[model samples]
Target chain A: MDSELPPLLVLGPPAVFNIFKSQYPHKYRFLNAFSSDLPLLQFLQTQNTHPSSVRAIFCNQRQLVTADIIRSLPSLGIIATSTVGYDHIDTTECRRRGIQIATLGSQFAADVADMAVALLIDVIFKISAGDRFVKKLVPFKPWSFPSDSKLGGKRIGIIGLGRIGAEVAKRLEAFDCIIMYHSRNKNPSVSYTFYSNVLDLASDSDVLVLCCPLTEQTKYIVNKEVMLALGKDGIIVNIGRGALVDENELVQCLMKGEIRGAGLDVFENEPYVPKELFSLDNVVLSPHAAALTLDCFMDSCRHVAKSLDAFFSS
Target chain B: MDSELPPLLVLGPPAVFNIFKSQYPHKYRFLNAFSSDLPLLQFLQTQNTHPSSVRAIFCNQRQLVTADIIRSLPSLGIIATSTVGYDHIDTTECRRRGIQIATLGSQFAADVADMAVALLIDVIFKISAGDRFVKKLVPFKPWSFPSDSKLGGKRIGIIGLGRIGAEVAKRLEAFDCIIMYHSRNKNPSVSYTFYSNVLDLASDSDVLVLCCPLTEQTKYIVNKEVMLALGKDGIIVNIGRGALVDENELVQCLMKGEIRGAGLDVFENEPYVPKELFSLDNVVLSPHAAALTLDCFMDSCRHVAKSLDAFFSS
Candidate 1:
């Protein structure tokens, strides 16, 4: 801990903290909350040795930076997160306080988009299901084999036309899919047809991809009516937060074949995926790791470092 | 069985035969060889009731149309296959006999390319592996979770830059991959870097995708040397024919950790995947059904009918 260096509070686990230290050494003297025995608020109070010295906080997905934490750190002027979504942070309060917030925007977009497409194709084509079928050496009969739908010309409804949603749209265009979208506001640059609400989008779409952020308005956005409107042959892909779709409704839809399938990378309560999904061949589950690829993580670290450097230089 | 329709010889199992018949009823009276207990040659003889009446042969992947079959069908003027690859058909013999061949050309390209990208991302990101890991409730720890490479910024070497290969390149380009290719002859239309030989391409690429046709020149093209050149962290995706890669050498390389992983839609033998691959988490296998999506199949049937209609009208 060098007193001459700027104090930066880190509120993540060891893996990311260690990477940050190794990649950007001596730039900031990091006080890791995970390594500290005291509560995060008390830890912040201890770091306030020199008044207004601790001007930066670094966090990842594992920690929440609430209004209380913000009030406790009076010197904190900037919060840089290494994750794409900033729902874990109190963005409204931060905005009111004039505290600058930096996120790994568009860095995880490509990888997350890739995962979304991967899961969609996997579900529609039964790629993972087919792999399991073959690996189990179930009798090899072509006629008896499960059939899968083609991706071309399918109606794809994207929930958000932001960076990740746009990337997904671009990739699916090569497959000749008909792209439609629903967003907070219509993007003028894209030619994709926009729907004002999720219900109409689901009614017209064969597949609904959720790439929007999770907020109070967005939580449980894909309710029973939306799923029912999507129809029996429809599919859903969520690379965004799990809470965007009602988990219980989604489970019922899958079980009753109300929807054809789902490709999920996020869950309502992560690391504790519903056991029901395990037996369903139509659903593909990932452990909330859509953006955990090596390149994305490394790029995120670089982005965090650059944001910190820019903030201090300013 | 209608004598008024043009006689067409059908050779394959029932699955594709049923689809073709349902899609194009009364276009051509199909002579079902599989329905008959007699040999395929004998079946062809039975169909040759009127000389030059049986002008076309329709076949799928399950059976072969050898030079002998071409000689046996003296009145055969064309062969329209419901598959993308013509390796099962004696193309040279047909060419020498002045018999025109119509294939499901570029019809399956998009679907196959979709499968190729699906498998590549699956291998690179360990999507299937991660699903299995979570499904099995393997103890949850961030560090213990499998780490996967990213698709963006990877050097992707394509074996053939034809219809399917070019489609693959186009899709991978969206991921920010640097595309290089090896083909029988360089395609001047595209600007992707071309290598005269695969060895050089393998050395420079982090991933090698095979989309070339299978021929004597291409059989076992990916041998031990090529795998070694690709190094231990390399990935190979084959949406082409199985014999394009030396299966034995590939299994050894994977077992010994000479290469990173593989995404195989085809195998050296149909419906008989390498048993060793069953235990490996690094490889993703399909039952030679990359282009067998329902849309591709329906489109292929239409193509075959169109070709037959044109041939008769001419």
Candidate 2:
């Protein structure tokens, strides 16, 4: 409502955009794209009398900041996403334009890592399965449920020992899990064993957890060979992107019993999970909502606000 | 099968009894109650030609070691249970008869703690709820799923600072949760803040986890007043006995939204969860299988065997 406040463009829905506006109520004047019936670019141009005044773009995971959108914002100095992953943004265009980008970064790392560990334990111990069994009132028999694998002393192979992976390792350490990891390069500070390749990691691990960023080089990283290497008793947990794993291969592996089980938070096509996964008892499926907690959302809002303030001040 | 070996009575089903027998076949001569067509008491008397030779009883959670059963085994020097909880055995009678009792004490602590943490995270983060949402193809609308509470920085009150509770506290510490606890006595060794009463503990905690042994004093420990003190946003995780919390009161609390949610591994009546819980989204039900992992089972077997050897040799 204050004209003197720098104009900030918001490309997300009102629910998320409102949080940003409320977080920095007087710091910046928010121009919400979803508020108007006009096209995003047209809305952006008309909402702010001086288009060049709109210096920062606040976006969410659902909205993509394409090259066209980025080109339209002539004076856009920085893009701050309320998500850990920045793949939704056109980084190439931003690089060419010399625009800065800031992500939620480690703000979501703890929450996502919590989810990764939750899924891993759920799958391994059949927590959800047992819940269903009890709730459904399945007949009680000797060993009615399948025997679950223990979390302690299991060889856990973490893919990408970034902030989230490191947090997962830290939490699982109390369980006495033997931790090893596969990252781009070895993290000398961490004592966990490192494997140069995913295949070797899978071969040695009882559980393979995907925590790396999704990129061109890392797409479909957990392929058929990796799953096979993980062996019949092995399990996979992906709190990262669905594309990081070959979804079809994963499905096939689960169906044919090539691998033991999987705990998936993200699917190849989100909100469009394979119908086949619905009936399987071995897999635990979560909506792509590892970082959807109220705390994480609030933290992300604060991170975005801080980034905006820092960028403007700089 | 060796007649010269000390006789050990097994009161579980053939499936579970077989695991114990095979674990240490040469160590003791097993007299399996399920193997015979007669009743357990008749099998105990008839199967063992010399009833006085039965010096130990190997039992699982499903079977109760009643006062009569203990009295029937005239020479029963010890009862070795393959479970952490020994409530199934009449401790009064055991004490009266001067019979030693050995339980799988700390062997299953890590596994049970793992389950407690798993259930807590699952309930707090709505892991299973999100899984159901994705699996059921609930239309993806913005904020369709309820926002979840984060694990980090929450006040967690653990009931009982025993081995399992200690392990739980240790694991949760990595998540940055503020751990406080209530035990029969203040645990001087533990740095966690101890509340002298359950109500006080419930009032201060966002999550109240039951890890205490069920006893006359502890039965229905979490009553209406305690649940009320926990308030509308609090969650309860029970990896302890079913009767520790008043199940009727719990169902009412959940129904009336007195508490946010519950993650229950045990019930007032297990294998027969309250039918009402089946429809509720707030609760996660597990069929008393928290310590039912194959690793725990194997470890329990080993513990029982060691106890037998120790008791006999002493």
Off by over 4 Å in 2: A1-9, A12-15, A21-55, A137-148, A309-314, B1-9, B12-15, B21-55, B137-148, B309-314
State the lDDT of candidate 2 residue by residue for A1-314, as single tens digits. Answer: 48888888887652356566666788887787756888876776676546667788888767789998888778998998877887779999999999998887876788889889999888987877776676663344444545657888889999999999999999888788999999999999999999999999999999999999888888999999999999999999999888999999999999999999999998777657898888777899987778876666677777777888899898
How many Å off is the CA of B162 in candidate 1?
1.6
Model 1: residue A153 alpha-carbon error in angstroms = 2.6
Scored against the native two-chain complex, candidate 2 gets a DockQ of: 0.60
Docking class of 1: acceptable
Give candidate 1's error at residue A299 in angstroms: 2.5
Query: lDDT by residue for model 1 over B58-85, one digit each (tens)?
Result: 8877688888878877889888888888
- Per candidate, native contacts kept equal 0.58, 0.75
DockQ of every candidate structure: 0.48, 0.60
Q: Which ten residues in a row have the lowest lDDT in candidate 2 chain B?
A: B137-146
Q: Is the docking of candidate 2 incorrect, acceptable, medium or high quality?
A: medium
What's the C-alpha lDDT at position A63 in model 2?
77
